[model samples]
Target: MVAPDERIGPAQTGALRLRLSLFYAGFFAFLGVQQPFWPVWLASHGLGATEIGVILALSIGIKMFSAPLAAHGADRSGQRRRSILVLVAGSLAAFCLFALTNGFWPILLISVLFYALWPPVMSLTESLTIMAVQRASLDYGRTRLWGSTSFIVVALLSGQVLVWLPPSAILWLSLACVAATAAACLFLPDIRTERSPLHRGLPIVQALRIRALSLSLAACGLIQGSHAVYYAFGTLHWQAKGYSENVIGVLWAEGVLAEIVLFAYGGRVTRHLGSVGLITLAGIAAVVRWLGTGLTDSLAAVVVLQALHAFSFGAAHLGAMACIGETVPASLSATAQSLYSGLVWGAGLGLMLLASGWLYHGLGGSAYLAMAAVALAGTFVALRLSALTPRLPQP
Candidate 1:
């Protein structure tokens, strides 16, 4: 396959990067609003901690099936951008139901519907973005950093807005961001890659047979999934400790800012440490981060812990992307990305969210200790993965 630059000039390559940056900005802006405050919106409706946890867990768990199924269809059809447009449009429709529903059951149904079409958007986009990287020589981290930038901006603004507005305002803000993302998706490049003809049988089945890919994904999932408690209850925990929404927002944005810094230099970092090293570093950072988060509520200590987001999230994410780029074939890209999103962030995070509910209910902030344990286990897996796949070659 010839590089896209051979056919398309530098101007078009710049345009491709621009479109991707805008899309990331829009999508993650929505996430910025949703991730930090969605629980607040749930609490406004009189739901208990356990109920909120159940709702969050179920939404993500459904993606274990939904994400892979969506990516499979996209791969088979060779229309990933079209599939993404449809999914985001559907997600907008599903989220609108939140305004009509109030109770747990009604909200749960809508959450499942929304997420089934939502989370896969990221996986599909990653597939497209990576294809762009391979074909056009675009930098993945620089392209993705726009998302982190938008997240930081939106989160900081939302924090200030919440100081004046009620929790209900979160739903409306999130809706607007989702609509923006849908609009942005229309401009995404429909880059396609040639698949390996040797591949046969189910894509997921074929993918799982690769020990390096499977183990690395599993290890990454455990590490990322360890964020379940923080995702679900970090805001609530801080509020209970007497911090204001403004402070909570700053804390959230601070973490992503750290992520932004890492992504900005990701190419250099990835070259130095490689994918295995990145995941190993992420596991180590997770242990320190969650342990510190659990052991103290002091703003000073938490601020320091939040800085580790660079390694815990950004590094692990870069590692996973690099691993997929090296280990998976072009034909199975979407399937592999979807499996990472579905199995790792989906099922792995879902189960952790469930356990987090019980742990937080009984032990409060100390629940982070459980997450630390999970991260430590993931670190061991990463070490084993490194031992097994010393150097995975690109297909």
Candidate 2:
């Protein structure tokens, strides 16, 4: 029998793709529930806006340290699946602690443990998926779109469920999702790359020396981080506007539905636009989307703006993955992926979450205008990035 880490043939490729797709479905189902409603659960505990902000920001911020450490170890060990299993198992254990807590401080402590372990799973999975894309000639977007599909389904279902159940029901729903993720991890392919050489100092530090990669990371960070206000409070904002939970769920699902379309045609889009072009497009879309969101609460207008999530999120994400896969060596792939997630989602978004609480509390829906400015800054960075890396990655 061939080694698990060896190059997969056609027979194995089919099975590998199936297993990876299942993992994405299970994992993102958890996010579908948590992303839109977790704030409601926190609010139900009587924590004010500032307290919720601190909890969310601190949880994300901790990833800056924890993600790098976990990925670095994964890189050194060259055991992607084992590392993922361990992380997901720990995440499940930490998330369960929510059942035992009620107050801000106690919940905050558990959130630190949960968020720390939960996000690195995405980074590592990205590394594995990209490897599959290269070796098996799989379409990265199509395979990954399974996650978005599951996300939308679960979001819609949970929305209906929340209509009947109390906010605390979110806790139970999320627990089941987390357990499903851990169970799914057990079936993931063990497609390990060669261990990264540690004698060369930190891989991420070395990665910083590549000008194109550095600029790409910065550009992606700003663009993705611009979603802070929306992610943290979009549901709550709509709730205050008198929209039902079901409608709010539909709005969230609508955005990801557009994202799914983009991912389904990812390869063709990448070929036409390239990585730099995609990021440029994303920045532009974000500027318009946030501005429109800030200006109007009309259902029609909100629906139109939400569609821009395809470019702002889906394109930016594909562009970043292409940049990493093209620029980084296989040995350093896990480290590079982790660095992107840690810095962009972890630190960049964490800071924005901190500011978003203040922004939302003070300005309400108008807080989206601030996010528009953030996207505008990212557009400038991406434009400059286009000049530095004239020949961009097409993956």
State model 2's lDDT. Answer: 0.86
Q: Write the per-residue lDDT of candidate 1 for residues 94-167, one digit (tens) a residue.
A: 99999999888899888889988998998999988887766676778899999999988898789889999989
TM-score for all models, in order of appearance: 0.89, 0.90
What's model 1's TM-score? 0.89
Q: Mark the 10 consecutive residues where model 1 has the least summed lDDT.
A: 1-10
lDDT (tens digit, per residue) of candidate 2 on 97-185: 99999988998888888988988897898888887777776678888999999998998789889999999999999999999989988
Give stretches of model 2 more than 4 Å off.
Answer: 1-6, 43-49, 233-249, 296-299, 360-366, 393-395
Poorest 10 consecutive residues of model 2 by lDDT?
1-10
- Measured on C-alpha atoms, candidate 1 has an lDDT of 0.86
RMSD of 2: 2.7
Return the clash pairs for model 1, or none: none
